[model samples]
Target: MKETTGFREKVVIITGASSGIGKAVSLQLASEGACVSLAARNAERLQEIAQECNQLGGSAIAIPTDIADQQQCRNLITKTVEKFGRIDMLVNNAGFTVVDKFEDLQTLELFQRVMNVNFNGAVQCTYFALPHLKNTHGRIVNISSLGGIVPFPGNASYAASKAAMTGFSDSLRLELQDDQVSVTMIYPGAVVTKFQEHRLDKDGQVRGSDGGSLYTEDMMTADECAEIIIEAAKQRKREVVMKPGKISRWIKLISPSLLDKIIIERVKKIIEREAQESK
Candidate 1:
């Protein structure tokens, strides 16, 4: 890999900036003096993060947006450019999913909802931000998931959306190769965050938003995940699937049947937990 320019005074737009990896990435970049444009539906929290970023030594602005809406996506980019003059990075980190078997979903619209934010939203934001990114020779760090490449049981809707993202990012990378807008895809494993708590109910409403991590075991912190992400973006790496996620992808390609057995066991445990929670 070649040595890359760092994020100092570079303008960046991060979706899902109210929590988790997006928030972590925002703070890290702020500490390094990157102008960050924060976007999320949570307007209050978004403003709070923007303030924190400014105090941390970077210029920051909160742009409340629901990326699933095409007009909101455009507004996010437009506002960022209006504030910062140019954009150097667009981090497509906004996504959500329901925790249930595919067949158990109440409506097919549930899947469409997930795809809207996880895949189409990112594409929409990119569509509006691309012209600015091209002007600055910017980077597009797409926060994908391990599920994008592997089959994650009980959340195939989420997996399908991320798979679409993976395919889009790769093709976009090739298309923009000569334009100098680097595309970096990140496939992360589990991380500790409020995201786990917000499982969508069968009615398509968010659940457990004020709850704890869904997983029982210890997991990587959002800060740690952000550190890895920022480093990869700074280095402009082609793509990153860290550690066990890397192993999972390899196993998926070589022994899919073996992987399916593992997923079935995991899904059984998840089902058991959901039953207990319902009780």
Candidate 2:
């Protein structure tokens, strides 16, 4: 396992730092002595996390930001630079998803919203932070999802947005290769987090189902996911996949149809179980 001790005094800006994987990453990096900048729409939560970072013997500042807005994205980078003098790493982790099937919805607005937050937000932040990152020979860590690589049935918009993130990260990595900047894309499977509770439905309301049982027994914890990300950063790895075994990845690469069949069967089982329990 790669050690996070190398992060001492590093300046890392993490979007979506109010909770879930983002929050875990912030705390872990802070504990490793990184000066963390916590960004999220929730000011109170960000401040709370900032306090925790300080308590953990690392410096932190809270910057309330809605990454969906381009200006806010720019401001986040600007504030981080002003406070920390340079950006050693930029973690684009801000994103949300709607829980309904794409065909169950009529409007493109929700899809656009997902793209705005998941893809465009990262693009804008990267644009603003690139100069500072170039100066420091920094790193970019994008928190994409397994859904991006292997599409899910009820999460078309979310999957599409994450797929865009994966593509963007790949291209950006190649472009920055000669500049001493590294780009690492993370494809995480199901993780224990508050993400389900915060997701929206097709109508733009908070999802009605609790989604607790939707996770597999082997789901990773948010802290575990964070640790993987930190290790990737430390090693400047090109990519990381959080699947249980390498077979799944190989299946996708060699025969996507086979992968899709497996996913379909798994999803069918889940739906059947949910339907039976609803009775």
Candidate 3:
């Protein structure tokens, strides 16, 4: 028998499809002849990506959706099924973050806001798409982060939301095992995207485009990250953890104190930098 993951002409619904990993995934799958439903809060950007996907040889439709909204999540699934007839995959890639000292006296609304989009949003979409996915014996690929596995500083809410996803994906895989609906969890280290630029500040203000440039670099690109996710979904793998996250998980298991010390030092530098910026 030929080993075909049956990718061609497969129906895939990707959230956070406006940019970054989601956009990259949409284009790649489109090029491979998948019918992709692009969902995101940005209607204009979603349309642009959908157009690009269609031109790349895949059928594509843009459904402006906010996954955080349950009705919209339902609409995303409904619209995709209506257009494509069936769903082969659901990629939960939408994310939100807020950068601030955990002890800052700022309004703690950032936690709920981040959770709404990151965790709750993914949950909503997954729940709505599960029925469709079960019927097709499809796949659910979550775009988690390395921060979810190992402790990280500066973005508590984002990390917690991703951690929630890590746990959710694990349990969901077992629950859906009998249904033959595979769940693939991806823990990418750090992908170069508009993630930081869109992050909220301590006061819940947008950090703007310059936010990501100041923090870090030398990381994987969105296109590279998308490739890994696409392959993992195709294989229906249990989990795909990146190299750095794997090393950190090993270090944590071997010597938790050492990992704690490392995290503390990094947090110290982050605090010092924030102090300087605030002055």
Candidate 4:
């Protein structure tokens, strides 16, 4: 996707802007002339990214936010409009995984947490930004995952949350079609990000893993992921699926039953490894 030089003077609100894909997109958009508002829970990380944007001769502000809270989500949009006078784009990118065997996972609690941040958070942000987005005919880019489209074992909660976002994006897109507001859903395969380690437990403690690796070996970098997301937003594409792996996409389409079998086998292996390490 060509970087349009027209992003100049536009105001963009990005959740999960403290690091990874969100931070990369914030930097890219800001450098391309958009005034960016970076929203995330980690104040220090947010400050670091904001400083980088400012140093790059771009305008930006770090707004520490816990997107799970509806009030905070509302406040984020309000402050962005107050600071920039309008919101031209919103990137709902705050999310993490709770990848564990269904039997080992605290189903209800984990499901709620994932849904609150991945689905409810996006809803709240979009709801609050609707007026501004409507006024500007702006765009909404939601970061979902391949798991949302193709089910995977050991990621039931995360997959469910992303699927909810996908469905919500579709419905919302139709509702806003007459208003000229575009909603784009991004489905990325595996990307090297802090998502797996940042997943929260029922007590809010982040799940830790030795060496911290969960993505498949062929995972793309966060920059690549952000670039695709930017294009989807700019082109106002209905959906963007990146790293369309041959075997993966084929498995999803050609034989979903086979895909489920493969997922179950891998998940069983993962469970076995976890069990051995715990002992």
Candidate 5:
């Protein structure tokens, strides 16, 4: 992919940089000459990605961090500042989900865990990065989901957490308008990634391949999603809804009942298929 010149020499911190969209974004930014700080729970993977970024013609550092922990989140920011001096952008992309009905066993735990990582983690990182971002007139690119706006079944926790993130980003954008710190929210539909393989099941166990085909043929690629995010950051776009057209968003806003009916039918089919597979 061709590198964008806008991010040249910028300092960027990306959480969940070990794999998927976060990893793709880090590589794209690095290729564009940005100094990337890679943060994730997997230290080894982070280091590997950092090495790759360094070879990509830009600087990078590996900061092993579990965003769910407040102290670790603080450390991530401190380490980034220590290395880069200031933050030009912060990508809060660290999150996970559980695939099961709302009434499934251990659903509460799943919900809490999802919230801690998806919502609380982002909040903590943003709180620490704000001061530096304000200094650089920086940007915050949050990787939210389409589920946040139009939720589907079997992933209540994921949808709720993303919805909360969208709300938080919107409010923060308003508050920071005068500060020159831009906030961009990305609502991705479905992307081809290992996210489903790592998601939790009804028993709070890592969902294996038995979960069946979670991604559809129409899903976006991680690199494609990353490119959109990089562009949004460069242009300071307020929001992006990843869809072929604006009809889905318009329908949701204009006739929510109709949208809900569509979602309900699709979800019912998925649930029924899962039930059949289990038997």
Candidate 6:
């Protein structure tokens, strides 16, 4: 089916807009006629994206923001409103992951940082965008992950933050039903983004690494994930799970034990081997 291009004249806000799925969505929405507000910590990269959007004959602005700060999130929304007058859509796509078994590598400070950006960041942005979104009967797209639905031992903090987003979206969906503000949670399986390369290592430090067992460049592209997310948002869908082996979905439904056994044997092996090799 041909996807609908229903974003014309819409004022959309996208976090983590400098790259990855966020950049893909900003470009896609702008191409479809939305006035996109791109937010991130990188000013130079954001300007490049804004220029690309303008070249497509779409309105866009770069808003340098660190979503971990509530005031900055509010400022992003406020500045967006001042520029485009109303917000029609919000894409919460800014997040990173820290990979290690909870016991082997868990650190309070690291956990807090993950929650701050992955969970609190979205909360702050959503809190401010809700009013503007409600006014326009707009959409909120929270980019969660399959980890949110099913737990991965090495990704405890990441999964927990994403799970929080899912729970938040579910409750907000009910609350905003009367307000005409739709909350959609998207759980993407494995998209080709820079997410894994930028993961937090075991020493509670940020580092870049090459492709591993999962998160392959051969996996679905960021643009593909963005397209699905955009379509779901346009239709105001409640929940979306995109592109994984059928087992991933089944694990959420029936027989987590069976799935856990399979995942632990195979996926866990790869992660373990990768961790050993890295060390």
- Listed in order, each prediction's TM-score against the native is 0.94, 0.94, 0.93, 0.89, 0.93, 0.92
lDDT of 3 by residue, 74-128 (tens): 9999999999999999999999788777888276677888889899999999999
Better of 1 and 3 by TM-score: 1
Shift in Å, residue 158, candidate 3: 1.1
In model 2, the worst 10-residue window by lDDT is 207-216
- For candidate 2, lDDT tens digit of each residue in 1-279? 223338899999999999999999999999989999999999999999999999997899999999999899889998888999999999999888887888777798998999999999999989999999999888999999988878779899899999999889989988998888999999888888888778888888985456565666678999999999999988888889887435787998999899889989988998898787667
lDDT of 6 at 239: 75
Judge candidate 4 against the unseen true structure and give its global Cα lDDT, from 0 to 1: 0.84
**Global CA lDDT of candidate 6, please?**
0.86
Query: After superposing candidate 3, which stretches have Cα over 4 Å from the reference?
Result: 1-6, 214-217, 267-279
lDDT tens digits, residue span 1-279, model 6: 112349989999999999899999999988988899999999999999999998886899999999999999999999999999999999999998887767776457777778899999999999999988989888899999988877677888898999999888899989998888888889988888778777877786655656434454568898998999998998888878876644677775788788788778877677687797778
Quote the positional error of residue 65 for candidate 1 in Å. Answer: 0.6
Candidate 2 segments exceeding 4 Å error: 1-5, 276-279
RMSD of each: 1.8, 2.2, 2.5, 2.9, 3.0, 2.7
Q: Which candidate model has the greater TM-score, 1 or 4? A: 1
What value does the lDDT take at residue 17 in candidate 4?
97
| Residue 241 shift from truth in candidate 5, angstroms | 0.4
Error of 5 at 266 (Å): 1.5
TM-score of 3: 0.93
Model 3 residue pairs with clashes:
none
Q: Which pairs of residues clash in candidate 4, taking residues 3 or more apart in a chain or in different chains? A: none
**At residue 218, what lDDT does model 2 achieve?**
78
Model 5 misplaced stretches (Cα beyond 4 Å): 1-5, 210-212, 271-279
**What lDDT does the true structure give each of the candidates?**
0.89, 0.89, 0.88, 0.84, 0.89, 0.86
